[model samples]
Target: MARKVLTVLLPLLLCVIAFAGLLLLSIPIRNVREPPSYKYGIVLDAGSSHTSMFVYKWIEEKENGTGIVSQHSMCDVHGGGISSYAENPSEAAESLVECLNQALKDVPKKRHPITPLYLGATAGMRLLNLTNPAASASVLSSVNEMLSKYPFDFRGARILSGQDEGVLGWVTANYLLENFIKYGWAGEWFRPKRGTVGAMDLGGASTQITFETASQTEDPANEVRLQLYGKSYRVYTHSFLCYGRDQMLKKLLAGVLQRHSTHPCWPVGYSAKVFLKDVYSSPCTSAQRPPDYDVSAEVTLSGSGNPILCQQLVSDLFNFSSCSFSQCSFNDVFQPPLSGNFIAFSAFYYTMDFLQKVMKLPVTSTAELRTAAKALCNESWEKLLELAPSQKSRLADYCASATFVHQLLVQGYRFDEHTFPRIAFQKKAGDTSIGWALGYMLNLTNMIPAGQMHFHKGTDHATWAVLLLIFIMIILISLVMIFCFARSSKTQSAI
Candidate 1:
């Protein structure tokens, strides 16, 4: 009776053991359909005033359309932007060495050769190219040459159009926020409940605003159409060159200095002697340079930090009266009715972050922002420097920066109290930055297909192979167990 019981139960035990083995095998089999390895790409954001290198990595295969890229590492060049090296283009290339070395350490050695390295110059280089094409070409070539020496696959450097800059930044903002595509619990990609957000980037040499709007774009030039993950987006984008913080400051100083001596934008008791040439060298200010003034001439500026006067000074920079379109956002640029939330990044983030930190003020509304600006602008320069020792370089300009952002957004872009709070001043989303380079890299990545395994639906080589192997192993184990048990029973009977 015991032998009979053993004979019956042993096969059932073997079946249960086979079932467990099948369960254990499923993990690897499932993983086989997933991304087997990671792929990497490097993007160099060579902006007008500064350069930053970003490393991005993604799975080799994913069902969520293209690979989901996230920032792996970032390095800011020690000196000024590539355009700053106009006199010595070689130094521009050399400036990248420190950052490249960091990337070398960040990315595994094996990925260096396969990884694509790209350099995209923004408004600074654009301005340089417009003013001096040969110098621009030289800068690009030198930087390109240096990038070639590294192990990465060097993609040539090029200037991104103002429109491209704005649109790509929009893409980066939405992509990082997962506004373009979301991974569903049902194991597929789907659109999220929240709509896409607008992107507002204020850099050193330029500023950009891009958003998707249901309203028709009156000017076709401002309309940008993009398809991501099988969904379409109609976007409105405009990049105001030479309107960044630095350029904007130059504009304010020039506009104010043209008529008066004291700069209402600057804080009280602060003074500086700036050369007339430095302010008017750029194309943005070149047109504003007084014919009678010498380029090398120096003039002193005193700070007033008067809110109303400062706003008026900043407002003088925009041409709100010259709108040919039904609606315009300063400078006659046709912008559809403002829709969705806006992500203010780069200088916007850094400047607001500094003000909020230094003054401990919440800049949620226009009124709060104006009050904070008044407080910071009215404070003595010595007190500010004492409070924020690290902000020494840009400490004096905080008042002007705050004022320009306000005037530009509230007046230039027409963002009111209700819409002002919708703007999220952020430098990064998670570990990734909200910049154009990531978006540009994502667009380029579509061209490079992931070399993932291809198989038919439900019945493919990999699936069949796994199932067949498991079945054969189960059958063999069952046969062996039955044979062993039968022999044991037979031997017992003989005994």
Candidate 2:
């Protein structure tokens, strides 16, 4: 009887122990523990006025449709824009060394060899190319050579065209907003079902306007069709060169100043010798002449502090008479109605920030901007410097720039007072700054793939956990039945 009991109990105990072991294995097998992984990319925004290095990082295994990359760190290159070194292209290349050194510190050493580094030169380089082709080539070559010395994979460093500048800026804005995926189709947010916001980038040498319009674009040149993250977006984009605030100031000042004249656009107590060559050098101006054509002449600028005259001078730059399209946004470019809300950044944010903070203006009215500009222009030089000490040298141009901004939006872009509120003045969206650099990098990396993996951690994990628990419970019940049956048989045999 004892032997039979021992034999029955031993087999039953073995079965229970084996079942328990399998349950323990299922927990770990069902729950996969993946180590964290990261990827990084570097984008160099070589704008006309300045250069900034952006270091971006993202999780290695995130969904493809969503923009997971965020700006990790950024360092502004010391000195002026790369285009400023047209005369000395070597220095332009050298200016990036400090920024690259910072990047070397920011990105992990192991990732250096595989990390891509791209440089996209904006309108300033475009202007330089137009004015001096040889200098532009030299500058690009020098910068490319310098970048090659670093461990990062040197992607082609070249100039982005006006159309790309505008459209990519739009991409950056929408991606940051998550517009493409927020209201997308089925299991994954792969298709765009919502309207994308417009983007207005105001840089030092050019301004870009891009948005989706309801009206059909008759001219193929004006329409830009893009397929991003498996979604199709038809957009109208145009970049107006020489329309940037600084360049516009030069245009207005050049038009107003007749050799040795007191320009009404200048602020009170401001006197400077503005070069004729600098003023009329850009092709954006109707009065533009070759830089060498009037290299020897200088226009003496003395401030009169007149606001009315400033608007008049800036407005004269726009040609409202010709339009082959039903509607045009100055320079005879086909611009369908400014459909969506606009994100105006770069210089737009700076000028608006100054107006809102220093001038105490709401920035909604052309009249209010006009009034504030005149007030700043009429203010004493000492007082103006006190308000913006960092911009002491350039303070004299604010009066003109602020006034020009108002006129440009109101007259050049045909933005009404009602639509003024739609324009958001922002430099960043969360951690990412508003610029085409992010968009350019995204396009190059193929980050937005045509199809995306559907990953819902909570639902998938819960389903697996529940199913695993049920499996373990089923094994426990089966083991108990076998143990009972063995005991019953042993008892009957003993009897």
* Top candidate when judged by TM-score against the true structure: 1
Clashing pairs for model 1 are none
What is every candidate's alpha-carbon RMSD to the true fold? Answer: 6.7, 7.8
lDDT of each: 0.83, 0.80
Q: What is the TM-score of each candidate against the true structure?
A: 0.84, 0.82
Error of 2 at 275 (Å): 3.1
Best by lDDT: 1
**Residues 1-495, candidate 2, lDDT per residue (tens digit)?**
797677667656765765775555444232257665678899999998899999988767652545367899999999988999988999999999999998899999998988899999999999999979999999999999999999998897999999999998999898888876553222223444568899998898899999987689977887987776555678998898888776777777667764326767777787888776676756555455553456668756678777777767767878888998888888788788878788999988888888889767666766676667667667776778788898877778777778778877888888886787788989999999989998888888877665542442323456656765666676676677677877888899899
lDDT at residue 310 of model 1 (Cα atoms)? 79
Q: Name the 10 consecutive residues with the lowest summed lDDT in model 1.
A: 447-456
Q: In candidate 2, where is summed lDDT lowest over 10 consecutive residues?
A: 183-192
